[model samples]
Target: MPGLRIGALELSTPIFIAPMVGITDRPFRAFAREMGVGLTCTEMTAAAALVRAPEGVAARLLDLGPEEVPVAAQLVGNDPQVMADAAQICVELGADLVDVNLGCPVPKVVRLGSGAALAREISRTAAVLEAMVRAVDVPVTAKMRTGWDYQSINAPELSRALEDVGVAAVTVHGRTRCQKYTGWADWDEIARVKEAVRQIPVLGSGDVRDTALIEARIRAGAVDGVVVARGMLGDWNFLEQTVSQLRWGEPGPTPDFADRLRLAKRHWDAMVVHHGEQHGVRLSRKFVVWAIKGCDGAARLRARVADLFTQADLDELYQDILHAGEGPTGWHRPNFTSGEG
Candidate 1:
């Protein structure tokens, strides 16, 4: 797993953290990078919303480090002009690449002909892709699905079309818009899309929660890389660990349970510093649940932590989680596949 190359930047691995609204903000993005994710994108922001200053959302999503090169800013909307304008803003703000969102299955987004809704209108989708790619000198990428539904599994054709317009890469989430994350993703379709295109990396974007699924996708033969979405929310280590496995051909030695917990705490502390205590503790709550996933009593801890708003309260709960167990057992994890949505 040598770092992935997107135009001028070479990522250390193919494991990029997919942007999730209200989820993949700056602390989360930086945490993933520290843990060795190859690339990280901000949560999807509306192009229309950017008509005003995007600074509020921008502050939450932006990060730049020498090692975290090729940072991508993902934008979502229906209007070709707004998408182009917003994409230009992202590029000017130091984005190494700009990713257009086409696979988000959220109801609010799809209803607006943004996200996966764009999957239904090939002409408009083509227009947005071509305009965005041409609007900025930076490489343009797109994240999309199999189609709007089973009847519309048009990714292969769409992939070809997007490539014709010069999209540097395409990520295919196996489920269709109608599926709404309810069924298994059509990975074979990802392979189809990859074959349909000639000059870009095609990434498999669904059901890749761990190394096993990753190897399976690579074996299927269409993907140049894999994207981790929900699997990364609670565990920042996913990317770093995945990279070691891909690079060394072996799972690296596991870190101690306490080590994992400290990493979580550092992330929490960083959040508190970055966003202040109230919001930090609130945001940190979800991560605590993810960090303590493998342990017994995690549910109870999550319930308790939800009400906590102060630093001391967090400290108390964190200590309780640490002491309740005889020792750290690392994170609890799930087989979260986009198809499972």
Candidate 2:
């Protein structure tokens, strides 16, 4: 497979890990990169927050390790100039690309006239993206839904406008804001966006759980690439498997229970080092839950995760789980319904 070139930055594979809020943090991104993900992104950072508090929590959202380079910094906002300034800040902080968030369907974000709300007005969204393009030297991209609702499907038109305004690539999550994560993604709509754009790459997202799905999309010429979102929750090695399958027609090795436990331990340690013990332990619980999904005694393990307050507590649990010698012999498939983007 040829590398995906967005502007001057080239990715070894076309498979991208979505910029999921709260899940794609610095530690998690670094881990995904090590797992052979073609490209990674920071969690969606609010442009206003970045502008309002560069030294605050919003700035911390831009945190990236050297190992996670060539990552896109995703920004969410409606103000063109503020979004522009935020894009500049992202570039200054070493983002290889800046992606505008136009697909997030969360009520809080939509209420602010950002996220999917931007897609409601193509011209305004284009103006915001144009300012961002002019503000940074890196490639500017946008991730948008099909439209506000089934009655207002407009990704094809919106994608064209974004392309005209210097957006390098567009990722279409094949659902309208109204559908949220329910129902099947409209790949037909995604294909329409691909047809609407004349030059830039068009990637597809939503419900992409396995390599075969990616192969089907790419082979059908509906999308230039696939963005793995919730599918990557517990299965950190998903991207690696995807790359192998796409390139070699082989799904590659699946990690067993012991392997997963070890990986989970490594992830826990990294989270601790990145966020400190107190916050890190709490932040890492969800990841632990994801990792243990489909494993024997998973429910019991999940119940214990809530009480984990210290490294020693996690360590004790890890040993017990390891000694229990339970879980799938093959790769664990994450239960996406239990989580959100």
- Candidate 2 per-residue lDDT, tens place, 74-150, comes to 99999999999999888877789999899888888889888998789999999999999998999999999999999
What are the models' TM-scores? 0.90, 0.95
Question: For model 1, how does the per-residue alpha-carbon lDDT over 22-44 read when each residue is reduced to its tens digit?
Answer: 66767777788777777888877
* Model 1: lDDT to the true structure: 0.76
Q: List the residue pairs that clash in candidate 1.
A: 3-11, 3-12, 181-341, 182-341, 293-332, 294-331, 294-332
* Weakest 10 consecutive residues of candidate 1 by summed lDDT: 59-68
> Highest lDDT among the candidates is held by which one?
2
Residue 104 CA displacement from its true place in model 2, Å: 1.5
lDDT per model, in order? 0.76, 0.85
Model 2 root-mean-square deviation: 1.9
- Candidate 2, superposed: residue stretches over 4 Å from native: 54-59, 327-332, 337-341
